[model samples]
Target: MKNEKCGGAATPRWFGYALQSLVYLAHHAENDVRCPSGEIATKVCTEATLMRRILARLARANIVEAREGRDGGYFLRKPPETITLAEVYRALEMTEPLCTGLMDTASDGMIGMEIKGAFSGIMKETEQLMMTLLEKRTVADLVKEVYEVKK
Candidate 1:
């Protein structure tokens, strides 16, 4: 018998939110001004706590910075064009796609080895493709695309 493990889905919810928030921040990065957290949450139609968590992650990645005090909020740490989507994706990617159980069987059967090799290859290829595509895109690019779509 061949035992094999499978990877998870394409992207997580946090990744989606981080991408969206990055685009939003890039669109306003030039202003070099902070917006209220509540306002930002409302703009994205997400809960403030959720937004805060995402912002904290971004801040830790040095993609954005947060300020304290009544007049403080959040701002981009660097120019939008300098921040690649790949970087943001990497920052929020906290889990591996495949589980280890696939190859954890007590008996190493011929079929199991073949399945593991094939699945590992596919997963590696998929990850590479995704990384390439994401690296080619920047926050500025996303913001521009959004503007064009609106018009």
Candidate 2:
């Protein structure tokens, strides 16, 4: 998926899509059913291609599994409660730093350069805090938060 820049940072659109797809999978996991990419995409308000790309990443991360043929699709590789949000975030393997554009502008002068360095450190700390919080939560937690008492 093309990285869409927003407010000087590339908005993590893929992350949001991945979370939606994962929660859907979690809800359906009770039946042990493999859901089609198209069905998940429809449910998540995204395109099948995008869903496939995101799921491919998740598959590599071992968060989900995929199959082929007439009745093939994707399913969770583990229980929702076992899949942490941090794992999901890391699965996307996002390359763009969240302060991309802002950093670019930081090349203006001496103060800009110093501020850029400071910003870089701040970003790193922020990410660490984010991961720590995410590590404490799982897909099941999110599913519960969204659906409340899962069906």
Top model number, lDDT: 2
What shift in Å separates residue 19 of candidate 2 from its native position after superposition?
A: 0.9
TM-score of each: 0.74, 0.83
Off by over 4 Å in 2: 1-11, 97-111, 149-151
Candidate 2, 66-123: lDDT as tens digits? 9998878899999999999889888888776444666677788889977988877777
Candidate 1 — which residues are off by over 4 angstroms?
A: 1-11, 97-117
- Number of clashes found in candidate 2: 0
Model 1, span 93-132: residue lDDT tens: 5465423344454237887766777667666787788889
* Candidate 1 Cα RMSD after full superposition onto the native fold (Å): 7.8
Cα lDDT of candidate 2 equals 0.83
Q: How much lDDT does each candidate structure score? A: 0.72, 0.83
